[model samples]
Target: MPEASPWDGISVPAHTDYTVRQVPGPTAVPCFWGRDRSGACLFILDLDGDHTDQYRKNTTTINGIDVDLRGEAGRQRLVLTLEEQIDRDLFGGLCSTLIAALGNASDAPTSLAVALAHIRRWKTFLSGRAAHHLTPEQVRGLFAELVFLEEMLDRGGTAPAAVQAWLGPEMSHQDFIFGNTAVEIKSLSGTERSTVRISSEDQLESLNDNLFLRVYRLSDLPDAAGARSLNDQVVRIQARLAAPEQIESFDRKLVLHRYAPLPEYDAPLLVVSAVRTFRVAGDNFPRLARSGLPEGVARVAYDIRIEALAPFECDNDLVFGGGNG
Candidate 1:
């Protein structure tokens, strides 16, 4: 049987603006689940003056939900109200997920930060902008990014810093950005595939900054002893994070990327057959840049043959700096 939701058995008084039930758990901050006079659902976080401005600035319409900071001064509450169009079960899951994330925080400030970050992620999830289920290509793409992220983490840096550097899920032109250096990651299946797809003109364009392209050749090895599925890889990465906040941040990124630990993702285990790194610089590198395109030509996507990238090819050390690629 499914577990009972935090919103289970909660009711709202028809005469009042809201009827709330305090969340039952050892959370760093006070939280509540409620329903409004019209029977709409709500999740409220009672916050202090120190971070009220942060919450206020982030308040905005989240497609099927409304995010706002209510009350004044000492009684400020960051509220998330569910709209009629959203699925109640999904909202319940979201609320439950948020509560779990808040519970991991060490203090009210940390909780507030986590909540704000998560709300932004939920906005992306609810906007209908991301797919509910990751496609095969998406799975491979995300896997390659994770592989790069794992390599970064293995190189001995703060997990939070490394995870934060991953901006691909946020739709950044480059997958990973650190200062002026940017890396665009791609994955190809099987050895015979020779071309890599550049999704946008801005992806490889280097504007007074360093840019590199890293491609992973993946092979399906479902029966292989050490092969890993997408879900397995997620768990492995989570295990490497030392702090609760780091895990929370990474998990939030996964959510923003439209990943869920569904049973369907556990099949067709894969292994990285090979990795190729290339410097996306110099005049000879083949690419289509926005600056070079004709007027009004946008949303560009093109393919580059792998063999042609040889002149620009370089070691992974140039991109990640002394890391095991």
Candidate 2:
């Protein structure tokens, strides 16, 4: 016989205060269908209310999703509502993201934070604003972040601190920042890792500071059995954040990256073959800098040949794995 669906053989009990029905389809949590004060159908995801003080301040609305935190510690629930006209698949995708973020936990405050993050992403997506597409550059950048995260975790760094290093915005000259050190990552596809694009004069302009460039040479695998997606890496990182506040902070960072809660990254299987780290110091490290330009030259970007940069290439241990110390 075929496997039974999660929504199969469901029953609703007779209740006096409110009517509750099981949400349809597969889900990580047992969501319930119910009516809100407006008598509109709302899907409820229950959470432990242990630390609900932060969210109790106000109702935050991003896009169309309303993050309604209800009740105290023992009876906390996150109520989500949408128009009946919305597509079912999109709604289900949003729920899946919530489930992934909640990670089978009943803790209220922490779960609430993550749920809010997921909702924000979905709100952007469902609002019909997101591109629903991950460019090759974006995918490469995400892979680099994941690699950085893996390396940091392997070396016994705290998840909260490591996650804070992921500076994903376009404004940040570097991809990561920990303490006084900044790391700029460059990823190239295919075997021939020829050159890397430096986005601005400041990207490599930190002459006296602890700036590092991490390069990754990647290729796409066809039908690789053990391959993992971006979502998989995200789950791995999220698991390492032991504290509730840490997990919540991680989610916030992900939001800043403009990463919406999608079912999964639809990109190809990215495989990294070579990883190299270079300390961006000394005169031998050839590149453009603010001091090099005469004047009025800004937003300057150029490509650097990898072959000539051999002198600056150093062991990955120098940057990660506690070699920097």
Candidate 1, residues 1-325, lDDT tens digits: the string is 9777666787867687788899889887899998887778899988766566656654446677788778877667778888987877777767776776675566656676667766666666566655477888888888889989989888775688888899887888898988678999999987547899998989998663778899998888887777898867876676566554576678677877887555567765889989999988766789999988999999999999999998888888878665432
Q: Put down candidate 2 lDDT per residue, 1-325, tens digits, no spaces.
A: 8544332333333443235676554444456755544444456776644436666542356554555766676766677765556644555567656666677344555556566666656655655556565666777777777778778888888877887777755467778877777888888887654899998888886532688888988777747765566776677777676665776667666655667756557456767778888878877788888888888877788999987778787778877535642
Per-residue error at 132 for model 1, in Å?
6.9
Evaluate all candidate structures by whole-model CA lDDT and list the values in order.
0.78, 0.68
- To one decimal, what is the Cα RMSD in angstroms of model 1 from the true structure? 5.9
lDDT of 1 at 42: 91
Off by over 4 Å in 1: 1-6, 11-27, 30-40, 46-50, 63-77, 128-134, 146-173, 177-180, 189-194, 200-202, 205-210, 217-274, 280-301, 305-313, 323-325
Q: Which regions of candidate 2 are displaced past 4 Å?
A: 1-30, 33-41, 57-59, 104-106, 126-129, 191-193, 264-266, 321-325
| TM-scores for every predicted model | 0.64, 0.82
State the TM-score for model 1.
Answer: 0.64
Worst 10 residues of 2 by lDDT: 4-13
